[model samples]
Target: MVFCIRRAYRSEQAGFRAGKFLTNPTKAGRGHVNNLRYRSSTRKKVSLLLMLRSSARILLLSQAASSSFITSSSPVSRLQSAQFRTSARTMSEMTPVFTKDACPPAGPYSQAIKANGQIFVSGQIPADVNGNLIEGNIGQKTEQCCKNIAAVLEAAGSSIQKTVKVNIFLTNMADFAEMNETYAKWFAHKPARSCVAVAQLPKGVPVEIEAIALQ
Candidate 1:
């Protein structure tokens, strides 16, 4: 009976050891499963954070591109034109009109006419208002003609400084130097001009000048 009891006790010890071994394996497997689940959860979170950051960056870039397009396509904001009738009338109101009576023509023509910011002066000879021809050399004739043109330009609300174009007719081409010397004194700005020598002039004048001046 002592032998049998020892054997039974050994058997019981063996069974307990077997059960502990099985339990330890199951616990270890459960811990491995839990670790795998935690690892998966961490990976998913990292992926979601990366995706969110990428989405935010894309959205910011899109918004920036849209803002740039809007600014580039926008039109200018300043007023293109002003109300001329209400703003100012100096250009229109101050324009002068010279009639036949104001400056009697030396020949058969009007003195000057103002239209559209320009003064058109007829060809003026070396003659006074009373239709008397001026005498002397080419210098004297050029001075008289320039003075007549000045008067007509002034009557038309213009001046020698504003003269844009001029045409001079001289009976003698040799007198060009003398005429130009006197003409330079009247128009310091030196307007665009075309000088031609003609065989004859009205009233046998030495020089005649026509000018177009800006108001």
Candidate 2:
């Protein structure tokens, strides 16, 4: 009896290792073990297929997110695009105005700049075309400054009559009456104007003038 029990125990161990079991040790029992093995193999294959499908879904989602990031219309990006367009348009429209009929600029700046349907004249002191300070009283000095502005406007395809704004700088308010007298002769259309007194002006002149005129 001991020998027969040991033999049966060894047979059971060998069956387990081979993916089979001997419950009844008959033909029907062997067929049931084969059915169990088939079910286990089917489950493993189904599990592998599910895992592959899940990985593919994850990869597709990642690719879609990357594509969305490339075409993102965030606020900062939109603002940057707008600013670049504005800068490019402004640069293309801007053009410098120069003429020997006007006083030469005393510094590293254009005598006038034309852009956006307007001409912007730089501050003009009482100077001649050669950049020499003119010899005159306050009224004459103001007239000379207006003449320089007119020349710049003409060069830029604008005119003093089309001036939309004028900015006047004076070293003394006492000369306002004289300056206004000469200014009215030039800007008779009564464009927008602002006059202010400063400590001094360029080239030691008592007055400086600048203007903006429509093209």
Candidate 3:
């Protein structure tokens, strides 16, 4: 009886050891599969995060490039548009002014004519406001003539400094020195001038002066 009991106990111990060995391998395999699945999921999540970060960086760079392009293009477009308009306006404003009541011609000539943005005033004798001659010596007559020219120039929207050219007609060559002294005082800009003694002048005036002034 004692031997049989010992044999039974030994047999049960052996069976328990065999069952433990077989079940341990299946449990280990299941645990390894679960670990592999977890690792794969973590790797996929990390890859998605990296792709998102790259896409975000590219989007930011694209926006920055677009902003830079707009910033550079605006000033160039404004300059080109301004240049075109200025050129057109400059061309259009170059036309001359001519009117019927521009003070009747003193001697078969226009009193003040405009061309090329300049006023060409005819030689003004010592003439009254009514275009009639005022008779006097060189000094007195020159003052009156200058006054007349001033009136015409004012009417034409110009002034003495703007005078580009001047022509002084003298009856007597002896008065040239005195006339020049007085003319110099009036015209400080010193426009291009030509003084000549003519055979005769209208209304027998001693001096007649004409000027061309810019607008």
Top lDDT hit: 2
Clashing residue pair totals per candidate (backbone < 3 A)? 0, 0, 0
Tens digits of per-residue lDDT for model 3 on 131-170? 6766666777777777777777777788777888999999
**Best by the TM-score measure:** 2
Comparing 2 and 3 by lDDT, which wins? 2
lDDT of 2: 0.84
Which candidate order results from sorting by lDDT in descending order?
Answer: 2, 1, 3
TM-score of every candidate relative to the true structure: 0.53, 0.66, 0.51
Model 2 is weakest, by summed lDDT over 10 consecutive residues, at 17-26
lDDT of prediction 1: 0.73
Residues 1-215 of candidate 1: C-alpha lDDT, one tens digit per residue: 33444555465555545544444434557765765555566556556555665676787799889888766654431222234543365455444455432336755556876766778888888877676886798999888888888877776667778999999998899999999999999989988999999999987777889999997
Q: lDDT (CA) for every model shown?
A: 0.73, 0.84, 0.72
**Comparing 1 and 2 on TM-score, the stronger one:** 2
Please state the error at residue 130 of candidate 2 in Å.
Answer: 2.1
